[model samples]
Target: MTNHIIVTIGRQFGSGGHEIGNKLAERLDIPLYDRNLVNMAAEQMKISPDAAEEVDETGLSRFLAYYASAPVDYSSYYMTNIEMGQPLSEQLYQVQSEIIKRLAGRSSCVIVGRCADSLLADEPNLINVFITASKEDRVKRIVEKYGLTERKAAERIKKIDRERRYYYELHTGKDWGSIESHDMLLNVSAMGIDGAVDALEALYKAKK
Candidate 1:
């Protein structure tokens, strides 16, 4: 409804997906919605942004052990014996979808992750992209960027990828990272972020 070119980026873990999304927004002079969405959702839900961010991107419930494992008490501390009943990840997904829809309607912005590609599937002017890289490249990048040990970096990357894929599959019932879901699928390890953005801009202009 806003008539702005919406870009949704899906990426492999540690592939610089968020950075590329940010850079693209800066170049286009458009708003970028990424972790800010998590923050907003967190504020709305009265939860920590850290908590929201953990469950923000990727396949649903697959990383429950790693990301969404909220602390609970089963001991005498539970005098009420009533679970606070935290919002399910699916419910959070719905909230995020609504937030994205509202944001897109008001402005042309780049949204990264959080099932945005599928959520905006009906929009005529949306460009969905999937970014990926070789596991080796991702591992190296993670190590250097996060100053993590090789083993830790590899574990982190793999865990994040799994969670993302699980989330996508759970929410959309479509395989994550499938080429069909995206209008453009680029390997940043091959072209770099700027090159990818350039190619995307060209594609959008041509489509327009």
Candidate 2:
């Protein structure tokens, strides 16, 4: 394994990104960070993990303002001494940012999404990857995994990709899932999930 490796995977919905990350982490014998980041960040923020998870993907509209420094009690549920009026998404981003940096500093790990590639852009030995798939394959995967009709699956994928694009662009100012944003890009519909992981693992070793 490459020393001090940090592989960040930005993926399209139903592209098997999480599965790829998990396999890569296992093969590298390192921990994987995915939706669990929400819990970790929520814990640091002294809030319920469920609360953070709600805004993790789709984002929050009810709460506005990310002024952690201002400390105004605009809403009781959203106010802690340092969290008053803070936007849920941004607040979560700040905490997760700290955690991501700490994890990267500690040792090798695989991180999935949450704008991690951009967050750790300055870190050493980091491999930023974008995973994409054909729309037909993605829709089929979504339909099978979630028991949705093909049309609903397609719609969900669009909604999810839109949310991901908005979130990633909002924080990183880089085009989400663009060639410029990543060191490597893989089409899982072409290579398959395990095949993508295999290719990425080889790339990770060469990154040294």
Candidate 3:
């Protein structure tokens, strides 16, 4: 068995998806990628990691992403917002896709967020899993972890999920949270983090 499995996890905010990914990576002795993807993209583009992270999932904050990959007149360009445009977002997106593909080819790894599933769709050995939970469960988890009130937790969940959905839809042209988009759609509230990891491991082994 040549470490060929590529695990992609899309999760609800505060659902412990990253924790599960970490556990899975440790058990499999492979690398786990989440925030690190942004860092890598930043290094590749020679920009600040914070800037890369700002658009980690979203292609572009403005309409520029839609117009990217086309010729632009840089001769009269200045460092203004419109002039800078979506070049950075486009470049970061490309770097992220490349890094995910490179990691998929290199070894078995657990990738959390950034639409790794769609990015590595060409890899025949990839296993895409979506982790989600009920709104109430997610809110409670968020409140417990971040010390936010129930109302605030609910708002945070909605805001984060909205961004994730927008980013996924824009980049992949696929509906986020749809069962058709993932090989496995799991409810983290049902099994918790450790149990979910065990179940996922078993499922992957069965597939192998």
Candidate 4:
């Protein structure tokens, strides 16, 4: 059966979530939106991609009050913010959310991070996924990937995971990796990338 499904992946830093997403998208012949999302948002907002990257998935506590008070016209919110001189972080979020919605409406795709799960929560065709891995496995992957010592890899994992958790909670008011937050959670360490991809593809087929 042909499936039109939007897979939103929330993953820990060292988890093979990105690899899985790429493989799944390839298998399904669908577009994969990851860091390219930042570029897309930046282009729409008429800002440098580097500017968007600065606040990508990082909490904005100091600017939340201002953002909360802004008038929200979902139709043109991002453009409105550009005209209103909103902070870059707020602008990026608004633009990216709009872009994600537009992309979902246009086609089924796999979106990695940037709170795509929560942003598209109301969509009927959405599949929310969270990817995690054992700490030891994550550390090992990080050490190998970055040529870092085990201790440094462990530290990096903790810091990135903490930032992800904080950003997710701040934006969605939901626990980052809590089982209840997602339609499915996969442990990359247990299943490995290819196995995880197969499982997700199977799940999508079943759901469709």
Tell me, by TM-score, which candidate is best.
2
Identify the runs in model 4 with alpha carbons over 4 angstroms from their true place.
Answer: 1-3, 58-85
lDDT per residue (tens digit) for residues 62-134 in model 4? 1332334643223232233546777666778788988988898887899999889998888877889999999
Residue 145 error, candidate 1, Å: 1.2
Using lDDT as the yardstick, the better of models 1 and 3 is 3
TM-score of 1: 0.83
Q: Report the C-alpha lDDT of model 2 over 1-208, residue by residue, as the tens digit.
A: 2248799999998899999999999998889999888889878877876567656755322122231233333232453345366767678788888898888888889999988898888877888999999999999998887777898778878887998899899989999988998988999988999999999899788975
Give me the overall lDDT of model 4: 0.80
Clashing pairs in 3: none
**Per-residue alpha-carbon lDDT of candidate 1 for residues 1-208, written as tens digits (9 for 90 to 100):** 5577889999998788888898888887889998788778767766655555555664222333334365532222112213645444544567778999999888778898888988888888999999998889999998887677789778888877888888888888877898877777899889987888888777667765
Worst 10 residues of 2 by lDDT: 60-69
Q: Which stretches of candidate 3 lie over 4 Å from their true place?
A: 1-3, 58-85
For model 2, the local distance difference test gives 0.81
Candidate 2: where is the Cα deviation over 4 Å?
Answer: 1-3, 59-84
Model 1 spans with C-alpha error above 4 angstroms: 58-86
Residue clash pairs of candidate 1 = 58-164, 59-163, 59-164, 59-166, 59-167, 59-168, 60-166, 60-167
Error of 4 at 55 (Å): 0.9
Candidate achieving the largest lDDT: 2
| Clashes per candidate, residues 3 or more apart or on different chains | 8, 2, 0, 0
Question: Judged by lDDT against the true structure, how good is candidate 3?
Answer: 0.77
Q: What TM-score does each of the candidates earn? A: 0.83, 0.86, 0.83, 0.84
- Model 3 lDDT per residue over 1-37, tens place: 2358888999878788888999988887889998888
Error of 4 at 82 (Å): 9.0
